[model samples]
Each structure stands twice: as C-alpha cells, then as structure tokens.
Target: MDGSRTAALLGVVLLVTACGQPAREPGPTGCAGGVPSCAPSTAPPSTAPTTPAPSRPVTVLRGTVQAGVEAGCLVLATDRGRFLLLGGDPTVLREGAEVVVEGATRPGQATTCQEGTPFSVSAARAEPATTR
Candidate 1:
C-alpha cells in the first residue's frame, strides 16, 4: 500500500481497538498507596445494636376532666392549656372531676378528638373536695 493508505489503515485499527476495550473506573481519592482497605466499601451495612434515644421527660398537670366533643374522649382543661387525655384511670378521668395528672404531650399523635393537645397520661388522681 502507499504511505497515505497505510497511515489511514493504522488509525482505523487503533480506533477500533480503543472502542473494544472496557472502561476503567476512577479509584477512590486520598488513598495511601492504593491499599485495598482504602477502596470504597462494598460490604453490607452493620447489624449491631445501637444506643436507644433518650426518653421524653414526664409532665405534671392539674385540671378538670371534661367530656370531649367526641364520645369516649376525655380532655383536661388546665391553666397552661387543654390536654386530650389518653390511657389513664377511668375513675379519675371521669367528667367534672378535678384531677392532677402525670404524663407527656404527644403533639404528632393522631386522634379523633378535635380539641386540645394529645397527652398520654401515665398516672392520675382526683382532688379531694373541700368545704369553705
């Protein structure tokens, strides 16, 4: 072949060879001497137990138990605010009862009671009646 034809054939051969080769992935940066440990991890995530988050602090509230707009729902009208009482002694949670309750406010909790913030009552006691 003439020199121009030979050069054109060589360039075509090189281009085909390069196209057939697999692509090389970039290595992880900041590795010391390309160590195996320095490569990006492919191992499954850890299954070991982790420390639990801290519990919310309990609150004390004094209020009068009132019937909610919805049936079977009890609410406490306190000085701070009204609380939708959940899971407490039925006797102490009766309507028109004056009570002191210990619990935590659960703002994100879902409930049918439309009024008051949600309060999960841990304990409750009725206030003794006093004569003036």
Candidate 2:
C-alpha cells in the first residue's frame, strides 16, 4: 500500500480509539432547587479527621521527695503509690519531709513533662499553720 493510504488508515485507527474512551465528568454538587441542575455527590467528602486521646486529670501527689531527676522532677512515694511528679521547685521540697504536689501525670518520662506540666501547687509546712 502507498504511504498516504497507510497514513490515512493509522489516523482512522487513532480517531476510533480516542472516540471509544468515555470522558470523565466533574463531581456533583449540592446546589438548591431549579438552579444549576447540580446534584449531591455520591462520593464521600475528604477531611483531615483526627481522634484526640482523652486528657489526663491533674493528680495531687502527697509523698516524701525520693530523689530529684533532671528538669525539676522529684520521685515521690505516697500511700497510693510511687509516681514521678513532673516539676517541683527544689527549694520548696526537702528530702524527708512530707509534701503535696499537684500536677498532671503524663504517660512517658517526667523529664519531658515539664513543658506540659499542667498546674503545680505545693505546700511544705512542718505543722499545720494555726492562727494565733
């Protein structure tokens, strides 16, 4: 066959293949009555959903300061149990005396908890202060 005839045949084949393929349409929209003729989309909406873990409560730990770790953490042991109090001012807490420290008990190491250490309230009185 001549080059022109072969070229024409190839063009026809290409056109047929292109025409056979279905064209993709835009997603449906939820526009109101009798306006743009758009319908609600069957496909689900895309969202960056997140499930945040429940927040831990602020625990008041009353114990003797066991030992001090880095970043103002005192290992405390009370009647309840031993827990690493997130942050404690060294001057306020002593080695043997009883202490009541209020802070959040985070999941991991106490060292990192300093930043998120909820609200710390401490009281160190040898005897309950009485008014004269």
Candidate 3:
C-alpha cells in the first residue's frame, strides 16, 4: 500500500482502540487514606461518618474501699485495678470493706492521690462479708 494509505490505516486503528477503553476519573491521594495507591478510579470518596458523644456514664468499677495511706485520699482496689476516690464518705467505707461504686472517670482528679485512676464516686454500697 502507499505511505499515505498506511499512515491513515494506523491512525484509524489507534482511534478505535482508544474508543473501546473505559474512561476513568482521578482518585484522591492515598497518603491521607493510607491505601498505598493513587490509581485512577470512578468510585466515590471513602470516609468515616462522624460519631456523637456517649450519653451514659463512663465506668462503674466494683472493688473494696481501701485507705489511701500514701496519698491521704480514699482508694478503691478491685480485681480490675485500683482507683482513687474523688468525693465519697471514707468513714463507713473503711479499709478491707467490699463495696460497689459507680461513677464517671475524672482525668487528673487530684495531685495528692496516688497509685489509682481518679474516679468520682456517685453511688456506693457496702456489701455483706458473707457475699465475699
């Protein structure tokens, strides 16, 4: 075939191949999503929906009320762990006494309290020794 005809045939072939392929849209950067890729995609943006704050109480730890010897505050020690009492009557809730206390956690509750997470005691009850 002539040079011009051959060039025309090649141009048509290239155009047909390009038309057969699907078009793709640019995708978001992978670094922000940690996907490790930036390949072109037609999909929508990936995102996590915003969540609301919880309405209920944070914690309700069960432990025996112990005297805060080092910190001079009240402390509750249970199998879970130990926590310093923020506001509660330490008179009846004496050391070695089993009690169930419920309250929300207080971050940086008291500087003097030691060896326990700061916990605000909202409701508390002394249990019978027989239950132990």
For each candidate, what TM-score against the reference?
A: 0.62, 0.39, 0.50
Order the candidates by TM-score, highest first — what do you get? 1, 3, 2
lDDT-based ranking:
1, 3, 2
lDDT to native, each model = 0.86, 0.57, 0.72
**Can you write out model 3's per-residue Cα lDDT over 1-132, one digit (the tens) per residue?**
999999999888866765665654434543222222445556776677978987657577777887786746778887878888777666546788788787887766665766688888787788754653
Best of the two (1, 2) by TM-score? 1
Model 2's alpha-carbon lDDT is 0.57
Could you tell me how far off, in angstroms, the CA of residue 43 lies in candidate 1 after the best superposition? 4.1
Candidate 3 regions exceeding 4 Å error are: 1-58, 129-132
Clashing pairs in 3: none
Tell me how far the alpha carbon of residue 13 in candidate 1 is from the true structure, in angstroms, after superposition: 30
Q: For this target, which candidate reaches the highest TM-score against the unseen true structure?
A: 1
Clash totals, every prediction: 0, 0, 0
- The 10-residue segment with the lowest total lDDT in model 2: 121-130
Q: Cα deviation in Å at residue 21, candidate 2?
A: 29
**RMSD per model, one decimal:** 9.5, 11.6, 12.3
Query: In terms of TM-score, how similar is model 1 to the real structure?
Result: 0.62
Model 2 residue 73 distance off true place after TM-score fit, in angstroms: 6.0
